[model samples]
Target chain A: MKIFQQSSEFDYSWEEVSTSNWRKYGPWNEKTPHVIAVDTISRTIDPHTGILRTERLITCKQSAPKWVLSILGGQDTSLVYETSYVDPAHKKVTMCAMNITWSDVLSVRETCVYQPSSSAPDAKTNFVQRAEITALCGGWQKIKNSIEQFTVERFQQNAAKGKEGFEMVLEMSRKVFAEQREMLRLQQESKILQEARI
Target chain B: MSASLAPECNQVKEQYDNCFLKWYSEKFLRGTATSDECESLFKQYEQCLSKALKARGIDSMLREAREDNRENDAEHMRPKP
Candidate 1:
């Protein structure tokens, strides 16, 4: 079995990083509008065990670059199924597997980890992604190499998207926080004004 | 801000999401962990999501994945002698 792994680190709080990943849809860049939709099949939290489980079905139109499409043949919109287990207390999410049917002959499994980075300052998170591709037929070594190269390039692209997406979410969160704080302050002011009038 | 897998559920999901984000930063991270306000919105969104998943033939896959994940978790938690 050939294993391809990549790791990326980002300057965002573990919560922001983890939450963005759990949300999933934020990571796609504008170029991949081919990502049509995502559907959460189920989400459950074990009251006793505190493990959070979620499953999502992601649909994407296969708009690979010209060379890749030429090599792999034209693929219709595909469903990429993924399930995740999150340990909130430990601040870890194990994307057990993201399975996608590339073709009748190719199956792909991607596993990912999102956690706090020990080497980074307290505000950073480390993302580790691994993909395992299996070709079900014979005499496809050359094709497999092309797929590997393509997958690596996709990983790098995704890493950049992930970082940018995380920052975007972080900025939005901060704005929300400030807005709520302002509302609270205004409410307090109103309460004090009413008391003084009485 | 990610859209829900079911686009129809996006409205409710956003409502719950906003609530959760506020709660997460203003209360949860500050150590309160209270989630009383967003519960109903979350349930509504989940119901919409469940229906959408069933339509997409994804419900069974989720069940299977959850079962596998449970088994894996159990294995991980098992004490190594």
Candidate 2:
């Protein structure tokens, strides 16, 4: 089993960051072209905590290494099942994802937590992500090691791209939200002026 | 917006997503949401998606995955406050 962990901060409030997370794979993000489809399978709100829980399936298409593909019969598309909890009262979001495809041979499970940064609680959000990778090759110890190494490298590269893509989405949505707010303000002003004339 | 796994479910999925987002930002986050506003739309979209998943034989895989992780469910997975 191989473990990977990373921590980062986004210069945005918790609300803004969490909102942008839903739009991470919007059309504007060029970095995540491999993601083909995303489906929300189930969603429910806890009556007690008012926390929202969501289950989603994300399908991604990526070409594996030639050797790995040869060993595993040429499957290029992968499916990931992800569950997330949004605790509005506590201002935190936790997401857990695991690969549903090829789990018998190689399994990757990831968890992410998003919360307010202690240093700049109102202005910045902190993100912590951890992934566990396990490869079972049925007595092929050498093959298992190779697979783990390769997957770790690939995961690292993808994580970097994912962060970059999310930042772009965040910036784009911020501008759109600002514009909408301004439009609403103008509409209210016009309504007031019309009322005065009447 | 992201596309649904099934092309036929895309339209309904988009509608549901829009409703959910509005409720999430305006009501849920504010602790004022009385009920889920997108439940019906989600059901419609899920029906369409279920057909696709079954057709692709992915439903079983999803079920197994969810079951295997039942012990480590999201409620117990949150980080310490």
Candidate 3:
């Protein structure tokens, strides 16, 4: 039996995600069914207010066969069936990502962070950035209207689309994190449990 | 493109995604949610998406698609373009 479960607690770790073979799957065909994303060139600086240059692309595929049925049920009763790649139980994957727009200006950096930085991400940092992106997008809907550019609007939109995209990514990466944490937690729990056992 | 999404569709999409993640994260990751909730989410995703599509007026094209499942379910057949 299959059931849907949404995890409220997210484990933020970087190494587990960077290893995914996102390239082999697909590209940002916003027209297709898969959700895809790429980091954009951004710098964090407190430069005097100006248009912040930042852009990111996130795409996804939603396999709602039941919805497809509602589609047929509400309208045409004469229809039959359809085949698709949608597996309701399977978590979606991100296909491709790239970040080529690195800029020297600080205002543009505000897209990814509030502070400024010079170093590109190492493996460890990459994980941190991904977590930052997830946390940012998770709450993006609230701040979207404050901006003027279609770019920011698009950011809000993609944040909406990719929230699950990235969440799924984090969910997969979290399993390993949870297991490791569990091992450590168990050690700690055991010490406490044994005292209780005594 | 002129055929852009309405704010409603956008909101619905977000709700749908959140529901999706929560739905799966529980079952696959935590082993906490029941099978019934998963089925409920599956149906909810369809309605949410359908409403999103209707808000955009793209539901017709998806409805009329000729496919094997639609051949029997009748409801599975999308309307013509």
Candidate 4:
């Protein structure tokens, strides 16, 4: 007598995953302020174009990283692979590694996005449910460099040049990130500069 | 896009592009495949999109982006897993 029964392709497809409302993910307190969330409309990543396109929208300032736009690390997910480390010699310096893995997931797209009532209407949210995932298969050093490059290219001033230049800026950033005390000094200097302008 | 900035530009583009690609690659089918299977998946996607574009004609919308993204995308044709 046969014991195992064959399952159809349809059987393996995602049934559903859902969320209630968009608030600073009630959980992750640290990244919450930097976070924005979509209200939500549960839908599958459309395979119509043979590309996965989910229908979820999140409200946020237009200037946000796509990765940061992602849902938090929960709800049956696979990370693009990353790690954080603290250096020894420069005890305060922290290093982050982001590795890549090609095509390694099938996340079921869940909630879309909605803004609270008090917010402006007609503002477009820029998220879609995450119905897929993959790891960028690079080593920690490789991924760290990617983030360093992204920050400098997009946010900081562009003095970085050849390999040495990138390393310099990355090293500077590491020094600064490890010490929040410098932030107060900068803020005070900024206020003084603003006052001087007046 | 900056000529003087090309070195730095190239640096970030490599990883971001690869990371972005990985998000798509691991989405389905962990099983191994022949080169044909890989090419077919990408080509089939283009074909599928080609079929859908008759209505919205995203093909027309795609020209500029394809041209813009062509070199970037083509650079990764080394059969990365």
TM-score-better candidate, 1 vs 3? 1
**Candidate 2 lDDT score at position A175:** 93
lDDT of each: 0.64, 0.86, 0.30, 0.26
Model 3 has a DockQ score of 0.02
Root-mean-square deviation of candidate 2: 2.8
- Collision count of model 2: 0
Candidate 3 chain A has its poorest 10 consecutive residues by lDDT at A100-109
- Native A-B contacts reproduced, model 2: 0.60
lDDT of 2 by residue, A54-155 (tens): 889999996787998766557778899998889888898988999988888888999999999999999999999999999966868888888888888888
> Weakest 10 consecutive residues, lDDT, candidate 3 chain B?
B72-81
- The lowest-lDDT stretch of 10 consecutive residues in candidate 4 chain B is B1-10
lDDT of 4 by residue, A40-124 (tens): 1111222222212222222222343555224222222211211111111111111111111111211111112222122322222
Question: Against the true structure, whose DockQ is highest?
Answer: 2
Where does candidate 3 stray beyond 4 Å? A1-198, B1-7, B10-12, B15-19, B22-34, B38-48, B66-81
TM-score of chain B of each: 0.78, 0.87, 0.40, 0.34
Model 2 CA deviation exceeding 4 Å by range: A191-198, B74-81
Which residue pairs come into collision in candidate 2? none
Native contacts present in each candidate (fraction):
0.22, 0.60, 0.00, 0.00
Off by over 4 Å in 4: A1-198, B1-32, B35-48, B78-81
Candidate 1 residue spans exceeding 4 A from truth: A23-34, A65-75, A119-121, A137-139, A190-198, B4-6, B19-47, B50-81
TM-score of each: 0.71, 0.94, 0.27, 0.18
